[model samples]
Target: MKFVIYKDKLVESVQNVSKAVSSRTTIPILVGIKVVATDEGVIFTGSDSDISIESSVEKHENDQINVEVIQTGKIVLHARFFSEIVKKLPDKQVEIEVTDNFHTIVRSGKAEFNLIGLDAEEFPRLPEIEEGLSFQISNDLLKTIIRQTVFAVSTAESRPILTGVNWVIEKDLLTCIATDSHRLALRKAPISINPNKSFNVVIPGKSLTELNKLLDDNQEPVEVVFMENQIVFKTKNLLLFSRLLEGNYPDTSRLIPDESKTELTLQTKEFLQAIDRASLLAREGKHNIVKLSTLTNNTVEISSTSPEIGKAVEELQLERVEGEDLKISFSAKYMLDALKSLEEQELTISFTGAMRPFILHSINDQSQIQLILPIRTY
Candidate 1:
């Protein structure tokens, strides 16, 4: 393989694809990146089975030439060392050549490095996805959906299915829900597409998090194509494929209470800060629990007590309070995460009692809701 490419373009491609490279893999070749030089451009691929990222440095984009392929060939170079070398190369352009015997030479400016390259045939083939189901969404919107719910996925391996976010599409509305048993985050947006198609899928939280990093806050559209087992995300010159999680994601619809005994409307930022302060004392407690009690008609008291450490108490005057006065204790972390996901300035929290899970939502937006299971802080 031989190619001469601008150093900046090459560096960017390598850094982007490196998100998929895994060092602790059973397949030794998975630790390296597949660099394919063709007549059109240079393609870099990094994968570790679950996810793969393919980024290309095209010959010309927006009237700019980024790569010139001298010889059509393919080679796999160590991802870690090669990426670092490309970044530090003191030249405007990089020249790479691979011999038939797998010996590779990378040269830029006055620095030259020769590393053994692996046969590209050894790299695992990316899954071939046929046209099954597809839709287009704005990149900015997809990133927002990911950020709003990915944080709530369970980190424990006990319930493997809970480690992913449940995505359900019924007509034009797409809903994403994630929970770790303690806290749940949910987001919904109307997709601009045909309203006849319906689909349900579970995607790993880690995969969505990785895709979020690759997406810029740009105004371009992303094409999402999903089959029975794999999903593809395409935008510009980037293509990302991730395997779908199997098994029935527990029906969480019933878990969210339909009625509430107490409802409190408060400023989102103020409530978050109150929980933040309460958490400081609760951090030393067993469950990091914070208690919220309605002290007066519209005044809510937020307090936390640690047997060994001091206690914290703060009063938050709510914009409105209805239903019944209540007191409940839940993980401060859970409440904080749920509060941060809201885009509105004001929020309404519904409590079904001190034991049942509480629900949170924007004051005006009922499409997105968060649930937090209260902790027994006796």
Candidate 2:
């Protein structure tokens, strides 16, 4: 395959698709990126079986030609070397030409390199997801939903299902839930779409994390297509495919409390900063635990103690405190994560009791919620 591509455009597309190429793949060919040049434009594909990414550099977009095709063909080059070489090439443009024997040459301003390429025919084909179930969501909103929940997915592979985020779409609302048994994150967003379709799919947390990195914080819509075992995300010039985990995601609806016995409203940033300071001492402790107690003076006390080191105590003034006063201990790391995901200035934390899981969310935003299981510190 022979083609001339703009260096900046090529670098960006390569960097994007490279996220899916795993260096330790058993299949040697999987270590390379497949480039296909056609009359339309150039397409780059990277995959490691679990996830696949396809990005194209079209001939013209927004009235610009990013690629000029000299000849139409296909080739596969080592992903790591090719990507590094392209990015560092000392030119504004790159010319790639492949021979019939799969020997590829890369040339730029005063620099040339030749590498053995593989036959693109051996690459695995992306699953053609027929119109099964689909939805559209803004890129920024999707990124928000992913960041809010993916952190809670189980890192332990003992129960593989818990390693993925469960997505449930009904009517105009989409709900995303993730849990590691100790804590949970749930986010809901209303999206406009065709009526009468509901979807339940468990996508790996790793996949969602990758997708998050690929998305730009824009208002453009991302089209999602789900088949029996695969989910595809379509953007302007990119297509991302992830295999769905096989198993029923545990029902987490009942775990979230429907009512609270004690509720406290505090500034989100204030609470976050208090936890951040308290965690320094907690980090020295074996369990990294912090104690939170609602005080009678409309303040929440954040404290942590380590037997061998020291202790930290800080008070954060609250906007309001209601119901019964409560004292709870939980992982400071979990609390910080929940706090970082909040896009609000004020937050409300609801505690059912000192023993049960407590909930944290934006004061006026009910669509996003974070729950933390208390740590036993007797």
**RMSD for each of the candidates:** 1.3, 1.1
Report clashes for each candidate as comma-separated counts. Answer: 0, 0
lDDT of 1 by residue, 1-378 (tens): 788999999998899899999999999999999999999999999998999999988899899888889999999999999999999999999999998689999999999999999989999998776765777999998998998899999999999899999988887889999988777888988875543588889999988999999998988999888876888898888888898999988888888999999988889999999899999999998788999999776999999999888888898899988888787899898888888889899999999998999899998898789999998864
lDDT of each: 0.90, 0.92
Each prediction's TM-score against the native?
0.97, 0.98
Worst 10 residues of 1 by lDDT: 190-199
TM-score between candidate 2 and the true structure: 0.98
Scanning candidate 2 in windows of ten residues, the lowest lDDT window is 190-199
lDDT of 2 at 92: 94
lDDT of 2 by residue, 68-153 (tens): 99999999999999999999999998999998699999999999999999999999988876875677889999999999999999
